[model samples]
Target chain A: MTITVDRKIYSDKCISNAIYWLSEKYIIERKLDGDIETISVNDDNGENFRTEFLRRLNDFKLREIIETETKDIKTILYAKAFGDFEE
Target chain B: MKKYALLPFNFTQIDGKDVLINELGDMIIAEEGTAQKIVNRTLNDEELYKTLVAKFFISEQLLPPLIDIYAARLRMKKGFMDDKTALHIFVLTLRCNQNCTYCQATSREENAAKCSMSIDDMVNAVKLMFKSPSKHLTMEFQGGEPSLEYELIKTGITKAEEINVAEKRKITYVLCTNCRNLSDELLQLCLKYNVQISTSLDGPDFIHNQNRGKADSYQKTIAGIAKARKILGNDAVAALMTTSELSLNYPKEIVDEYIKQGFNGMFLRALNPYGLASENENWQKYNDRFIAFYKTALDYIIELNKHGTFFREEYATIILRKILTPYTTGFVDLQSPAGIVNSVLIYNYDGYVYASDESRMLAEKGNFTFRLGKISDKYEDIVSGKKVRKISEIWSNEVLAGCSNCVVRVYCGADPVRNHSTQGDMYGFRPTSFFCKKIRQ
Candidate 1:
């Protein structure tokens, strides 16, 4: 099964993390053709890897959004908690 | 809604509700799409808006007026790191009498030579333990059978006592032993130093004997427990049980066994993947069964609690404490920064220091991946060395890929030893991690 994930929607890191998870069960292959990233799962066992892959892809994308938005705030919070802060 | 700034928080869907958890583990359960509403600034509920602001999920000002209080609470959550290696486990000896079916310690026979800790090395380990800056210190003795080496245990305690005259640290002594031979002298030493007895009792006679690999093992252990209780008082002794393959089928029976033995609580510890126990072929199936077994046992315990009987499940209590309170637990397994050198260290019989108890078990299998340094080495070099620097990278789940965004990250921890032992790396892959699966479930 082959799925094309748009790089604009999901970054390469998100796709790679999703693949790292599913790679345990399936022989996954990936190719980058410009903005569209094509992912192929060599699952001859008839298992529906696409659903699991898409679920993880969406979850990672959500996580990526959260991390990108909150990275600076988290840094400030941690710094205030542990690091020497100039008030 | 008024314009508001977001404080760092994460959300996940559970029971058709959006459960939002803040940086300090404070949670709010709301209707579906609540997280999207909050993120999109479309939330219209005035009460929820107020609640979110009060819980540090959102800031009415660009910087929350109480940001210092929020940082203090966050600091308290990770305060175990500041305590700095409070629990020092001394592996007295590896000699054993009964062979456990799932012996993770890799115990040697009773007559095995060179398996016990030497006095010189033990004294050095005790001195090293005193060097820790923690005000409260726990010196726990563990072994194939710690009671078997009575003199070594005595020496270790006496050395600590002697040093504490000036150090004046509050020290706790725990003897982790199989109660097969809690002799009168040993019980006397325990009573003198106020040492707590922590012994193993797998279950009822049939289950315990089977796991202990002896026909008369249960009888000896029960008698020993009675003797220890008679000498040391009931409250001073605590028993723990490990869930073996056979033990999983009898969760209720196990709980009943603890009640029958007059224990107020039971710790339902699963068999770890180390030593002889690692020989089990199917950990995935075993982990699933263990989870079901834990739930069944926990439900039974809760039912007992509701029926005018007070019983506690220790593991659940730890989780509940994390969820319900702002304080940190002494449980090393459930600490951020991975508990290795932060909260506990192992002084092994092999004259080497290790990261944790499980690290010493890995050593029994000829894997010294966690061997920090020799007992004779300086404490600073051992704890702050290059290996520890590498481990520090992935010790906290807050920075890990899967766990950072997890709803339960606040209630969970990172375990580098478990990762290295099971996943071949210190930074574990959480998607299929058994630890992640069990804890998240």
Candidate 2:
């Protein structure tokens, strides 16, 4: 699914801090050790737009970016660690 | 005026394709307890701006000379590793009846020239263990399956008991076994030796048998646990660990399995990617998923406690202790991937000993340098060896950019050996590290 990330995900204490927030918005999952993963957003005939975890933010630089951003997305981070990866 | 709070801070940086922690030092200008309260409290927009600006100014403002004094002073007061040597794990044997995918130690092949410890080797190792100033010396026996050499253990305990009495030292004996071979005879002997049982039972029958395929491992283990409790008569027997494929699917079922077996506690363990058997398993760890799993499972256990189930998740308990208390028993799990740890020494099936059981497994692939000393060698060789000291130091500092600023750095631990084995790099510097991903959560 095409999802957008706020630059705040890169602020200091931002990467891990995003764990609590992001999980609420997307599913949290991992593949082997250093690989980045993303998934397709799905909907039954009516579910519309909601899906499991979008994808793991792969770049370490991206992780740092998520950690360094100062903005707080208190919108309870979405996450659903359910289902298999959609390739 | 530019000022940086000598408060604890971790500075993470991304370079090239990896992340490196430029710095990590928590200096509390305030007294001890004060730092814990404000730590990890995610800074707000204004606060974040101020912190970054202050750090930037300090980099540009302070002369290098003053920062050095401040850094050194913080290290002295907070001395991260309190007891130089806290736990002494001796691999009694490496023979197993089960085929677990995450068995970090190699199985003791019956034809692989297996040799049980002699009375002398046990006595020497026990004597060496007492040399450290740690008041309570805990000697834990681990293995591919330690119970295989019951004779050596019984004799070794007699010697350790003799030495501890002679030296006026206190020691606790712990055994990490598979319980499949736990017999009535073994239980009686374990009781006689005052050895607390630490066995493994990963989930229920289907999931457990698939990961650890011993013909009657389930029934034998359940019966063994019953016998162990009958012999010990109380909360004496405990479960050891192993993570598996089935565990990933049903975190709750695993917890229920532990509860059903009436395990004293269940350690949600990590799969060692390295090992003779596990190398080809290609198991993956989901950091974010595991974190959620940990929290959910632990919170479930807590809920069970309210219903009078009285259960504890070992991983969460240890982490909670680190967060809630001062100075833990120094379980290696709590130390950061960058933290230093004089490893648990592994005395293989034969007379040879290595820095850790994992080291011995590496030898199968022709990496022979793992042998730190012989069971017949001086105890000083293992404890004070240059190689052990050097390798241990590699993890003692925060080298990962993400962990540098991790407020939870003190609570998380890094495994250099795992990173080195899996990534082919002794030092992994990103939060993406399997070790970091799990521990940080």
Candidate 3:
């Protein structure tokens, strides 16, 4: 699951959507965000990826903060959960 | 106005690419749902007005959707050229002694036996370079090691002088080297030829030696900088560099070393995710760590700058230049691929000519390929051929998705080579690429 969250709206939105599309094919966990906030996900895999993604993905430019945000998150999480859009 | 006649679009399948493989087995990754998504969303639009939208996107033509035909005609005007800029890369030599891991130069101890360019070849290449719409030329050199073949250094100046004398064309020269073999002779040549020296220093001794390879790597490079500074004077020996695994932890150390060595600033570069290094597992550190590395280093440099530290960041300078200046060189990486072409060309040791050294580096490692002309052949055939036009289309064409909608498109340049490496296309949606994201930060 990839969670790409960049304020670079148009282009990144497309990438964000693509991650969702991939979700239909695999057990993917994805999310995109505006500003990165430390979230405590109750799911086991959720915390696993969050640690990796946050550790690697911040490049200061909003444009770059999303790609690694996708990959590192994908490696551990379950299901495609996008945005901070809560349950 | 149909360009297909001049240069046809050959939609070959990307080779061996599970998504789209062509005849030669080159890979091209294309998603399944994109075309359908486009079709589904736009199928029910009010009317067939895409031609108007297409014109708007490419030419900034009248806002066809905003009003009726009368208003559009009033708004229509002569279109501005939105093509990629000219880049003139002057390759000084294809000879290098060291065997670094990601050396796309294909240089080594064995390659040293080969001869570099004759003065005549250089003179012709320079003259041919000036034939583009680019008025200003960025004369950058790379090697084997540029210093190995010293005569070409003098010849580059002599040729530039000859052309500059007649055409009065402005040409800026940059020499890329390791500075290991840096000598008084080379420094003198640079001073004489008016070439600014750009060299690499990965980090401090142990790490740099591990990355650059060679026992004397640190001592020799530092010593060479001393000699380079003597001739070029202060700030003449520019530190243009690469980032590797060893360098990730040592950004502060790298900055400190650069200052100690008299480099006024630095470009805390990221390693290219390609070449010999591409296959190696050791070089692949977490991208997050890279971000962290940059954060620490950049903070340090910024602090240095805020306190009136004379240091400036070259990459930051390039970004700032694009942001602050009306005219940007836009080298596609840092350059606007859609602006005027600068008059620099890369002639590899084996006689292949590419638009830039980075292009050759990408091609040699097997992707984003373009050959302008072989030195053995006339420039007419290569430059006029379909491949050159194909590449030029990839560079200047405004039809790409990221580039089209990108507000930063004005400031950010696209590297087809980098894109091809990651996404297997000349125009990968850069705003979406991991490498672009890392660098854009």
Candidate 4:
């Protein structure tokens, strides 16, 4: 199974995470060429590797969106927790 | 779209409803597409809007007026930090009578040589335990069978009691045993010291016996429970169940068995990857099956509750306590700061301190990544050592990659030991984590 994921849409970290998770069930090999990353799977379990990979990829993208949105608020929250605001 | 700032919240779809969980473990379940609307800033439902605003899910103003209150409540949820290492586990020995197949501790035969904690080690461990400034401490004895070592149990308790006279800390004692060897002397000691008994009962006779690899295991365990309850009162004895592969097919049977044994609650614990149990090659399948089994058992328990049985699934209760209530749970496994050395510590039979029970189990397999220090080491040096300091880095869900943006991070915990054991790293990759999958479900 071969699936090409675009780096512009999904970050390399997200793709790496998806591959790491899927690597448990499928023997996955990745090739990166500029903005495109191709993942090859050797799945003997007859599982739909492409579907699972895409689903997790989308999930990671959603997480990235949430992380990007909440980054500042999280920073402020932690700053208030461990920082000396009075000084 | 109104310019409403986002508070720290995550959203997930469950039962066709969009569930929004905030940083303080507050949650709101809305109709489907609610999360899409929330992310798109198109939410128009007045009641939902009010809920989002009130629960610190969203801020209408530049900053929510309750930012300070939110931070304070968040701090309060982690109040276990103020009470450092309340649960102290004392591994008495690795020797046991019965040979359980799925035993996580990898118990040895009754006469296993040199696996027991020495008196010097126990005395030093007890002294080290008092170094923690926690006003309330619980000394829990664990083993292949702690009942076999009645002397160590007595010695540890007596030492704690002797120290308490001067230190004036409230202390509680717990004995985790298989219940097959709860002798009269052991029961008498338990009675004198007010030691609570925690025994394992997987299910009915067939399942329990099969798991224990003994024909009379269930019968003897039941007899032991009866004896302990009679001697120490029913309230002093508690039972926990570990879900094995075979137990997955009999969820209702397991719940019914607990109820029949007069237990009002059962902790539907998953099989941890350690010891002989880790030798099982089908962890992914086991995890999936266990999740299904947990839901089935929980449903049966709830049905029993509806029928006036008052039975509760303890793991769900801990998660629910975080989700539905404002208070934090004392459950070490499901706490932030990883709960290894923060809320619990283990003094093993080999005179070494471990981060948690699972940490000690890793040591049983010759991996000492989570070994804190020797029992003789100073408490400050052990907890604040170089290794512990490194572990502390990834102990918070607030900072981890996948955990940070998780809608359920508030309800979940950071487990560095589990991460290190399962993923070969302290900072776990949540995408592939079975722990994350089970908890999210």
B28, model 3: CA deviation in Å?
38
Which wins on DockQ, candidate 1 or candidate 4? 1
iRMSD values, candidates in order: 2.1, 15.9, 19.5, 2.6
Which is the winner by lDDT between candidate 1 and candidate 4? 1
Query: Against the true two-chain complex, what DockQ does each candidate achieve?
Result: 0.46, 0.03, 0.02, 0.33
In terms of DockQ, the best-performing candidate is 1
DockQ leaderboard ranking: 1, 4, 2, 3
In angstroms, the error of model 3 at B321 is 3.9
lDDT of 1 by residue, B1-441 (tens): 899888878777778998888889898999988877887789999999999999988888877788788888998888887788899999999999989999999999988999999999999999999989899999999998999999999999999999999999999999998899888899999999999999999999999999999999999998988998999999998999999999999999999989998999999999998989888999989999999999999999999999988899999999988877898887889888788999999999999999999999999999998999999999998899898888888899878977776779989999999988888888888877889889888
Task: Residues B121-233, candidate 3: write the lDDT tens digits.
Answer: 77777766666545566677777688777777777777778878877766777778888777677777778767777788877787778776788887888888778877788
Q: Write the per-residue lDDT of candidate 2 for residues B1-441, one digit (tens) a residue.
A: 233322223333223221121123222232222222222333334543354434321232323334544343333323334345546777666566677655667665633444455567776677667765666667788776777777767766777788777677667888887776776777777788688888778778877777776667777778877877888865878875565655667778888988777665788875666574456444444445556666777778788889988777777777666544443435664564322235355555556666655666776456655577777677677666876676665564355545444645655666666566666766654544666666644
Candidate 2, which segments miss by more than 4 Å at Cα?
A1-87, B1-6, B10-80, B109-112, B118-120, B285-296, B305-308, B336-343, B399-402
Report the TM-score of chain B alone for all candidates: 0.98, 0.77, 0.73, 0.96
Write one digit per residue (lDDT tens) for candidate 1, span A1-87.
Answer: 688889998999899877777776888889999999988877775347888888777766765766676677778788889997332
lDDT of 3 at B236: 74
Cα-based TM-score, every candidate: 0.95, 0.67, 0.65, 0.90
lDDT of 4 by residue, B1-441 (tens): 457877767676779887878778898889977866776788888888888888887788856687777777877788777777899999999999988888899789899899999999999999999998889999999998988898899899999999999999989999999898988998999999899999999999999999889999999999999999999999999999888888989999988899899998999988999999889998989999998888888888888889887988999888888888888888888888778899899999999999999999999999999998999999999999999998899999878877776778888899998888888998888868999999888
